[model samples]
Target: MSNIINREIKEIIAYGTSTNPKISLSEDQAFNVLLLQYYCFKESDISKVWYEILSMITDGKDDGGIDAIYFDEEDSKIIILQNKYSNAIQVQDVVNEINKIIATMNDFKEAHTGSYNKKTKRLLQESLDRLTDENEGNVEILFSSLATIDIHKIKSKLLGIEDRVAYITVLNKGNIEEMIEKLQLQHEVVAEDSLYIDNTKNVLKYASDQHKGIFVNVSSESISRLYNKYNQKGLFNLNIRRYIRNKNVDDGIKNTLDNNRDEFWFLNNGLTIACTDFVEDGNKIRLYNFSIVNGGQTTNLIGEYKGKNRDEFYIPCKIVSSVDEVSSQDTMKFFNTIAEATNSQKPIQPKDLKSNSPEMRSLQTLLLKHRVFLEIKRGEKTAKDINIKIKNDELAQLIFSFVNQKPGTSRSNKNSLFNNNKFYKQIFFKRYSSEVEKTEFLLDLIELNDRYNTLQKKFKAELSDQFNLEQANIFNNGKFVLFALFGLSYRIINEDVEISSLKSNSSLIEDDDFIYGPFISNYKEDDIEQKLKDLITFFVNILDEEYTNQYENKKVTSVSNFFKTDKKYINDILKTTVNKLGRTYLYKEFLEYGQIFKRK
Candidate 1:
């Protein structure tokens, strides 16, 4: 395991150094970027581009213990990366770094001043400002190194102010080995155990020519004991998903255990274990190289239970094994099938079912031709060097918002978009014949959506005084609607369409047979930012004006809720926008932009 960890570290170092050799980074500097990509970002693979990785490095003169800082928008957490890529990491050094970071946070909160570098100061202040109770502000300190240290020893030295952060996770050698194992999709069994089968009770044994199984009941405590001893050692590696800790579900499990122990077996799903082989000698059954393929949640909760009656309940158990006649590949397939099938009925999201659909595969293949990886399945590994990766669900929502102009439905009922065949086909399937044409069209919309999201994040972070209250509300809450309107507004600018005609017909917004295409702009890459900003400002101001008018006339009460209704958008906002339009940014700046459907 230690050797494997060393190899992994060397690979990361090599990756970092070779990504941009011109930068001439030291081993420590390269390791900082490596940690930023792998540990801080929590991405098993390093998919970030070189420049983005370079921007995360803040380890230099006047730096405050933080080697790199990344804002994780998904969890609203500020991840501070502390890199110590050496085999001689000491607990004292780890403790000292934590104290320094705590002091830095205090200094930032009090005076918002620090001796850190300019980037560090700005990022730290921004992170600190966002650390409000309302926002559920969390700070995660990632102390990464090649060496393992006593975690309790380091935590014992911390003061009470450590509560200000969420958790300080140490990424050391053992963790590296685990990560590598997951990447390789191979879990090595580190231990094995046996169960005392009740000879007095009926133990039904089933056997095919090549496969075998046994069905019996075992004390819940026995299963819990197995989890307690080997849970951390990949005892549940074959389970479809890890034990997701849910307080409510856990409480219910405990309630059954404490108050209704007799009915536990009837209420809970039983465990399914898969092993290489099992030997039944009299009353003892020894499972060799086995893992629980299902019921991981119950196993974990039962393991955590400390009630005196934990041993009083019995749980149904099914054990499956294969003889020497079965090939290793067949055994693995059988185990994986059992894992997936058992968990498939557990409140699966609609998108999970569509991951392997024809539409998804088609889009994925089309995107791959352009050197882009479409992650149709969650946690699917793509090429490490692939710079562009898009999630299928996100792309679907983007198209629904921008092309279909159903931003409300896009947000409020995204699952339906995948569940409903008509909507799913409209978004994911292209009407065009040429794959190149389809890829280009989707790529253009993707680029526009990316720019829109970036601008929204910037506006939120900067809180520019330029946007009034109403405008800010619309910009923040009406993101999908705003993107839809931006596209419609661009069309109005370029096509020179009469707003009166659009308002009178209304089919453009209401029709189901409408075929939408990509928006082709004449502006250069460097000019896009300013143009997008100006266009956003202009559209947001109009949206605000219409919203305020509706509010003053008692037509609507809540601006946010108003934006959520598609009918309200069409009846009031769209009408007002078109009625008020004139020669705007489109005519003044560039000559033309057009919607493209085919190559010609």
Candidate 2:
């Protein structure tokens, strides 16, 4: 029904069908390929994109009602796609496909794997295994079509499915059109009138390496008008924290404006804007292609208190425009650096400033040698070579676990821990002369923890009779168990006689010495694998004992609340458990017996 969407879809189909001469793809098959291109982007390397798309497509005669599938790792949600390319698609047809996908997901493991092609079968099995092992039940069933279906009728037919899934999204012709529009916006040239600031005063100038900086004070009314014009668009596009309503910081900004308007400049950190080009005329400056990389909260709060405050308040702003012609990548790096440096003065996490660091680049390059991807920036593109990538938040968790020896704290307070000044200072400020060695060790430790997590999930699934593992409780706190394992590894690395000898022999343990030395010597391949299994089993037993004690005594009110709110209580528990199991019991078991705990 949508002419724009139909035109684009037809173009894609024509290109796909014409390009592949050997294989005679059906219209439906070509449609599936177009859908893959639409979501993944055709500009990506063909071999890499095709390899991924081939694994997702199962549109043959005995297909399991799923045309394509994508797992969003960052959001922990599975997107099961059902494509109807025809313009005559109906409500009943769409409802039937939705039901089929739901049935397939419900008994995915027991489905007829032979019906699917080799690639589809392998992908399905792996995806289902990961979902079950990680306990990621959130799903999104997207029914996309070229035709416009009756929204009310479709909703009536798919009544209870919403309750089953996290949510169902219908990507009709309009949705596809919007996606195309957004993609086009990314490549479009900026217009002259796109950027505007009003009533500027007392403009002064300075210079940086390749940028000219202008400092000015603008009336609060003009700032409010500027914010109102570009409220939720791309004004503060580079700000780490977007405008969050009713936050304590927002309240504080409002209070300062209301009570002490004269001291506003002293109270606030001011705004930093980055522009590709700008024009100055007396007290008014018109920026071009500008983004507010800092002071997002101040901007939003000014807009919030626009009418309440008298016209006496003034806001300080710094506009840094590129003076020298540079490549887009270099410009991006420059603005990102400016945002990072300016925001360091405010309360922010280390990860927020980590993207532009030399250490991050070094780690990224080092990890690439091992076919690992280190994502220093949020929403950065993944490498085509590696399937697994580690983001900043995950890296922060690993650092917290290693430095603090409290995995529970890292897991429960993951967001808050990154913002904690003490934790951030401890991790980032340390010397990394042995960057590669420490990175390799940390990567292995992360893999080990992942294995422990998988085992915990399997155990919980098998023993569902005792208590609901999905429920938030101390007994089901997998992070606590993971921290215990980290504690054990910490002690082993620091105190093991073999590890000490290896450390003495080399400046630091060589990659090869990990096989025979103290740090991971016992953990070499099969030996370490079996020891991890036994360690998880022992911890499960300890968890059972703790659960029984808590149930009988009713000492804790809510396990989730206790772990999240009371850091001292969780840290105390971690210390007591590590002292008893990790230092005394598990330490002796690992050193003397190696994998002997399996027999016990």
Candidate 3:
């Protein structure tokens, strides 16, 4: 082995034996041999690089065609990479890549110009007044197997097309016989040549030290297998690596995962959430107003899509509790949360990137989490340092809301204005029916306050009917038999405005098509009075699934059962309201019901 390769091997062995070095190399000895060799390319250097890897995408997430781009600045054009610890390289993976080189050259030629081949050219460079092929420099040398590659083979095999692309190789052989023949016996250079048969045994010893012996060879072999075994055991211990990014998510779900790391995945059921509370495990992650199973949710706060890929911009999810294991349908089930992570405005739902399920989405959330944990000793008191990786993997999914400046996905700037004049009577706007603009989507929030004289009269009149009235209502309106029919709708309580129509907001917002984003359409009621029923059910279902799981996961069955009781809490909870934008509200007391029972 060359001196450089020997040094690299030393580092690999040191990685294991060093104080607490991250000894991650597999037990596969051959794999290590190839990696170390690859690291010894003539220009190779492994100094300090990145601090953390946040948003890592091996499969061109950014539309950049490179595999595994890191956040580090390459000190030189030469790059040194370490791949699988067990790969064995062959010859023709070489042929395929070589084909890519040939194809690139062909593309360069095909994109010709002016009178030369006007119609045939794909790219016309007007600046040069010629073709794009002339400007797209060269393919340059993308050397493989820096150390073990026989330099002679490169100099001989198809080494054509210079200035455009080049292939170079490095070697690591020591010819003792040829070396002795070349040394000249000069006065100063060879004066101390007292041959005492002094180095035959030492050479054998040097060839076998754990680090020095196998390092270069192992590292070398691995790089050669790049094209041959790129799909095999990759680098890392995470879930996204095994799922979405890797799986070819074609029409029908392709097996995108490498199927190599299954232990990191399993069935988790703890997914119920209400307002603030979720299942509490030591590993759960907490965001503003919500929680997610640690590493389960990714929030793109701005929602404007600062990320390069749609996958990076996940629907900001936070775990409400610990993962549960329930027998749901045929599969085990759990509730995964769609957090209330909003921008400056209303909260958004997890993007319907696809669909929700008993397993898929929850797994996606866990795969994208950023884990931060602390470890302590078995018996010692508090005294220790910390372990953190280089933050190279930053999140790519950026979030923004509907009230933003413009649609980023389009070239023509589409301003962020709703369709109604109040909503904006533009292209997508229209008139809404009384049924669609009913009690759920409120305009003003403080409608039922003590200062509103009409509130007292209306409350009394509404509460006079069949009774689901609270105990407090009985005390206030018992004076008249006609005062017991108050049915407080969330929209009325929140004081949402009632527009006769929304013909100005949505093109389809006809005199009767009630548009409430997509939520209210779930229950298309005929009468405006009946829509309140759907609003009540929406709240009940949102709470029934979310918060109840948190209550149950802790084995705190009491809170779960407490919800069934007809107590003061029910009246307090019922008094809660939401605006059309889904903002929560508190009535008499300042402590809102959603906030109060969130943990329950």
Candidate 4:
């Protein structure tokens, strides 16, 4: 029994938050809440052999919200539980969750017993029909709580769900003996003979603001079941952001929380939900600072990044991720640890930015451009040569700054995005489960999706009455695609107007093809209004078969940056003399768009 329980505990701890001050609490607290739960049975439960049987479903969303299924293999019944830990608990939230599980289960069963082959289809007919009829899934919910919960309200809600969902609430204040006795008094589920725990820390350590440990308001069985599900399925682990669901609101909360969430975590976000704060830092000292902007523009703040604890003032940074993980083994160059102690733990102003290193120069230029990241580390190592320690320390600051800043830098996007995705097919279509079937399926799907996309784009543009030099994207929810292509090339097909943006000093539209703005101003009094209208009409009517023959096959491939690598036969017709109305920055948009696309 000890083996099973101990293994479960170990897994939880390994994946969960640690009391050690060095770990990223956002990652830790998520795992911490599930660690303290256990399923209990007397030392003689027979079906204990089936202890390993667990149920779990992978949610498309990446948050670690794993719904667990625990059941005795020998029995013909199943129990599903949704477990979560937070200081605040709402009864309505639980009721809504039970409904979601029922829907998911129904969908799963439908997939399982649906048509496979003729024989299987016949065999699964009854199942298919039965499964199609949604089951009012009676998964027992063991809603756990880590705080001093209001049980009266909880009991009332649980009774309302008595015919279906089961609720279990565990308060923070309860002795092991009391907890055990309470479990015995409740209804029993299938369990194993093995159950054991060693010297457990009753008091979970928190860096500052919240609880020391995650309270188990749910069942231990739920924990064991969830662990096994993850193990058996070889889960890649869910990320925090997918579950949290990013939005503009999240960013606002993020700023406020970073300054107050913890003495330990110090930064708001996800890590370190609870903390009995130690010496406070930025998260600790209240910043009564705000700038009065002229008019009603949003204001900014100026203050020293006071230590909320070791975490707040001094944060490390990774070039890509917003949350920084602390690790000694990951030490290498590309680290940018904070040198907060020397800077009086001051917040970085627009001016605290000077460096001698070339890499630092790169970072400085990037910062000046207000790209997404701004890094400055000490100890004279180039990005590749920087020690891991320096990297870890700077990582936190990088995350904080990136998270706080609006629409961060686009220069150093981490994800790989080839323009073609292997020419779209190469990027999107890979080896499917089976070549014949998958290829047919994907081809059909892609064609359909393309049609839908094209129509969607056309509808959008027609309604908006907006058209530019973008390529094929003038058809769907492909504003970016159109913007990108337009910045580079111009195409004309009858009334299907091709738009061109002037990125360089300027370029004139061909005799036929609608040209958008940003024309360079070459003369003081060029008849601009009449010239533009005349040019728009002239380009539209001039489209001809000869123009298509000359450049139709040429593809505007992105070479480097937003620069295009394409074979284009520029026509002298489009190069007719023009009084430039303005300087063009059309290509610059493509540059920025490329950077943004890379990030997504």
Q: Candidate 4 residues 1-600, lDDT tens each?
A: 123323433444443233333433232232232322332221122123111211122222421232344432212124444544444556566555555554444444555423132222221121122111122232333444333555456556655454443223333322222333323332111122111111133222222231122211111232233234331121111111111111233334335535543321233111111111122122221111110111010011102111232222221111111123324223111111111112123233222232343434443333233222233533333433321222212322222112111011111121112121222222223333234433333222222223334454444334233433222111211222222232222222111222334212123232223222211222234443333223322222222222333233432111111111111212221221111112245323322322211110
Candidate 1 per-residue lDDT over residues 239-301, each given as its tens digit: 856564443456688889888988987988788888888877666678887888888888987
Clashes of each: 0, 1, 98, 68
lDDT tens digits, residue span 1-600, model 2? 566665655665555556566546565665666566655342323433554465467676656788877655434456677888777888888888898877776655455454555434444544553342233456677788877777657877777776677556676676566555444443222223332334444578898787898877766776777777664445665664444333345557777887888888888888888878777775567777777788887887787563355756677888887888888878777777877777656465457666777766776776677677878876567888883577766766766664444465566556555567777655554433355455555556556556656665655434344444323233444565445444444544444224433334321211121221123422435665556655545555555455445534644323333333224334434433444443455657645423321110
lDDT of 3 by residue, 1-600 (tens): 344434544654554444235544333332233333222221122222111110121221222121221211111121112222212333434334444434533553464222323211211111111112322231222323323334345444544633243222222222211111122110011111011111223221112221111001011112122212221122100112111111111111111112211211221111211122122222222222221122211111111112232221111122222233223321101122122221112212222211243222332222223221111111112222322211100100000011111112111111222111232222112221232332222111111111123433444334333223222222231111111001122223223323122112321111222223222223333432223322323444433343335334632222212232222122222222222223333222222221211110
Judge candidate 1 at residue 451 and give its lDDT. Answer: 74
Query: Which portions of model 1 show Cα errors greater than 4 Å?
Result: 1-3, 30-81, 86-142, 152-168, 196-210, 214-224, 227-232, 236-271, 280-284, 295-318, 323-325, 339-346, 350-396, 403-486, 489-591, 597-600
lDDT of each: 0.67, 0.58, 0.23, 0.27
- Please tell me which model should have the higher lDDT, number 1 or number 3: 1
lDDT of 1 at 208: 87
- How displaced is residue 285 in candidate 3, in Å? 69
Candidate with top TM-score is: 1
* Candidate with best lDDT: 1
RMSD per model, one decimal: 10.4, 13.6, 29.1, 25.1
Rank all candidate structures by their lDDT, best first, as comma-separated numbers. Answer: 1, 2, 4, 3
Off by over 4 Å in 2: 1-201, 244-246, 324-337, 340-477, 485-520, 523-525, 537-559, 562-600
